[model samples]
Target: MCGFWRRYFFLKTLRGLRVLAYSPVTRPTIVPFDDFVLQEMMYAYKHPDTIKTDDEWIRWIFRLRRRERRHALEFVEGWSGTRIAIAGTTPWLASCLVGIIWSAARGNIQTAFTVAGFILTSSTVILAVLAIISSVESSNRAVT
Candidate 1:
């Protein structure tokens, strides 16, 4: 009787699994940007001839409303300086950790400190570059 019940339960579980495997996956619909500046950017991206020069692109963004200008600046920063800084520094940071670990494991405390200091100095330089980029971006926004 117990063996028969086990077979029955197994068949029920298999049928349930088969039903789940055949079910269609439902993905969330991705909605496009509704903002005027973002929509214009999309159109310009699709039709490159619309804005021909860097000056034209800058001027176009400068002409937008204050909120729109801020949004455009943020979007540009996300794709450019800020993104580059984080992506470039992340690997250096990971390597810094590994170097510190390796040196400490080898009982070379001084070497570990040296490696940490050098990487940290480079990180500071990268941070300075990021600061300059952000300041320039802010100045551009201020000019309009």
Candidate 2:
């Protein structure tokens, strides 16, 4: 209610004045959102579901009052699909790595061995990380 109603009811305002003891909060003038935030809002609008990420689960724990839960499990499901698609194209990366390693093999045996070891370790580590990402995304889909 406005100040007049507040005075009529002897609320937090002064005894007989148009003064408000508390001032209203000012609205923020600007909001900045990244791609992730926009994608998440779109996911909620398109395919609502429980966002079952670990961080989101923690948020649910500290919620003050029960509000609507917009289920957006498709968010993670689509992410898993994208990860699988990326993993499927990993052969391209593998071929490039192999070419580099092959070129590195023109030197002495010890040099070739060390270079080969490093390239294989690094490239395979990338692939391994992709696999782990795929697995985690898939699990998130299942949980959500």
Candidate 3:
């Protein structure tokens, strides 16, 4: 059972990557939707009995909305970093996000939360680091 869920989540992540690679325009939505679906799938696995409840389902839907917001911010961050000559944080962030989703798929809430927090915090740190690097470069360029 656990293995199945893990594989499903992994495949879902692959599909999201494939979609992003094939269609850049819908990436913002697709990435978040992928996260949301993975989360809900985990949630469902943990709480199978509540599947019949509308409220329970709605909560899962809200997770999608949350993902969408996060996705938009990430996309904007990526774009700005690219434009400002900042180092790209996408590879680091993507790996962390993948770890978080994998944790969730295993139906381990504690692990999932820890992984999610790590990913979010590290992503912020990487972005800040890149911004500082860009600022330093800009200052150097100005002085030269």
Where model 3 places Cα greater than 4 Å from the true spot, the runs are: 1-100
- TM-score for each predicted model, relative to the true structure: 0.35, 0.29, 0.32
RMSD of 1: 24.5
Q: How does candidate 1 fare on TM-score? A: 0.35
Winner by TM-score = 1
lDDT of each model, Cα atoms only? 0.51, 0.45, 0.48
Give per-residue CA lDDT, model 3, range 1-144, as digits (tens). 336633321211211121112133443344434667665655665568868875875674455454324322111112232333323345456656776787768967677767766776777676577556645644564351
Instruction: List per-candidate RMSD values in Å.
Output: 24.5, 22.6, 20.6
Q: After superposition, how far is residue 69 of candidate 2 from its true place, in Å?
A: 23
After superposing candidate 2 on the true structure, give the runs of residues whose Cα lies further than 4 Å from its correct spot: 1-107
Please state the error at residue 93 of candidate 3 in Å. 7.8
| Whole-model lDDT, model 3 | 0.48
Query: How accurate locally is residue 111 in candidate 3, as Cα lDDT from 0 to 100?
Result: 75
lDDT of model 2 at residue 34?
68
Q: Tens digit of lDDT per residue, candidate 2, span 1-144?
A: 235522232212111111112123432122234667556555544444656564763574345223432222122222344444554455555655555676666645566555556666676677677556645645664562
